[model samples]
Target: MSRGAQVGVATVYRRFPIKEALLTEAFAEERDRTLQLLLDLVRRAQEAGALRRDFVLEDVGLALMANAGIRAQSPEVRAEASRRFAA
Candidate 1:
């Protein structure tokens, strides 16, 4: 992976003791950024009266939990499930 990224393997290993550790950190950082963006959008929606004032991050987390199951479906089913889920 480091070679594909054009970085030295030693440099990658120096920062992350194991490849799994590196992937875990990367995914976590991405998840945090996405959550922040979602929170901002939810806040703006609530301010505009589009979303209920009482809605919270836990509600979004629940929605995400439901959405995760959609990935197990076939592609066509997944697409339809995702559309309905978003709705």
Candidate 2:
């Protein structure tokens, strides 16, 4: 992990002692970026006239949650660190 990500994990660990808690907190950040990627996909779809403007952020979020590789190291730990990637 990069220094920034390491710091984020450290902060999370400080806030929550358990690794599972820390990973869950980190996963939320991952989810947000995944949601953004979905938003971009939606924008592209709209530009291509494939998706209607009626599509909302929630829809994008759901799409991302399903398609994005948001896998956890373990079911309990929920480590989405693999999703912490460079663009």
Candidate 3:
């Protein structure tokens, strides 16, 4: 993974300490990116008078929290669940 990222394997191990830690951080970064995109979309929708003015980013955050259980499933199931959840 570090090689693909053009980073040294030793540096990756040193930063993450464990594989689980690396996975956790990667998941967090991905989640953050998703949330940012959602926020931007929400803002654009609101500006366009599509979404309700009362709708907020926290609502999306809460929904993501509720959907967090999908992480416990197998990768294939998780991917499908995520697709459905987003839909």
Candidate 4:
């Protein structure tokens, strides 16, 4: 649950209708962590003069498509990934 504490299904389902909703909620923290890792890597590369200054959003998107787990997901997932990366 959002409280980060374990609770029974009766309590959880009282809030969420389906299991996927709960999964998506739980996945949010993980997604944030993954986004932070990717962003840190990109920022470090830029700071270290390894990433080109002219690199644009498309380049970042390609990198995510190549290296991120989002390659297999749908457009909505890609949009979420883009939003996460942009954050």
Candidate 5:
């Protein structure tokens, strides 16, 4: 997770119309890029026998949701949680 995730998520949840429109496009493009990158990494892992060939994109979504569930009392704490989560 990124350090700015707390702020970003808060912004998303607030749903300001103008900001939402811009953020929507920005996040959509970023999501596409991230998805592709993940797909590539998964493919590489499969080729290296680190992951099963049957692994699919839906599994990635589940993993991401699990990661996003992390929370903490402070930004610093949350950042630490994210780092540990990535590890």
Candidate 6:
């Protein structure tokens, strides 16, 4: 799923106070799920020679963070940004 599709999930995370004790714990499950999926895709990309062997989980984190930072004037633009990020 694209980041745009995850807006609700993101909103849920944002709802908790920044310093909430259980916030990290709550987000961990979703984070792990997303990480595993990214790892799977990375492995395939490597096998297809589209990605280098040096890729790591941290790169996935960085990519997600970068995508999250994207802002647009409208829903259509935001959706486009998510598609571009996925690509």
- List ranges where model 5 is wrong by over 4 Å: 1-18, 64-87
Q: Which candidate's TM-score is highest?
A: 1
Best by lDDT: 1
What TM-score does each of the candidates earn?
Answer: 0.57, 0.45, 0.49, 0.55, 0.49, 0.46
- What is the Cα-based lDDT of residue 9 in candidate 4? 61
Predicted candidate 4 versus true structure: per-residue lDDT over 1-87, tens digit per residue: 435667776888887789899899979999889878877887788889988767654576676565565553588877787667655
lDDT tens per residue, model 6, 1-87: 227546565565566546574468778999899878988998999999998789887887788888889899998998899889877
**Which has the higher lDDT value, candidate number 1 or candidate number 4?**
1
- lDDT per residue (tens digit) for residues 1-87 in model 2: 338656576566578899787678779998889878978887998999987878887774465566456566685444445334210
Q: Rate the local accuracy (lDDT) of all candidates.
A: 0.86, 0.68, 0.84, 0.74, 0.80, 0.80
Model 4 lDDT at residue 83: 68
TM-score of 3: 0.49
For 32-86, candidate 3 gives per-residue lDDT tens digits of: 9988898999999999998888989988877688678677448888878888976
Mark the regions of model 4 whose C-alpha exceeds 4 Å error after superposition: 1-6, 56-61, 64-87
lDDT of 1: 0.86
Better of 4 and 6 by lDDT: 6
| Higher-TM-score candidate of 1 and 6 | 1
Q: Give the per-residue Cα lDDT of candidate 3 at 6.
A: 88
Which residue pairs in candidate 1 have backbone atoms (N, alpha carbon, C) closer than 3 angstroms, thus clashing?
Answer: none
Any idea how many clashes model 5 has?
A: 0
Deviation in angstroms for 67 in model 5? Answer: 6.5
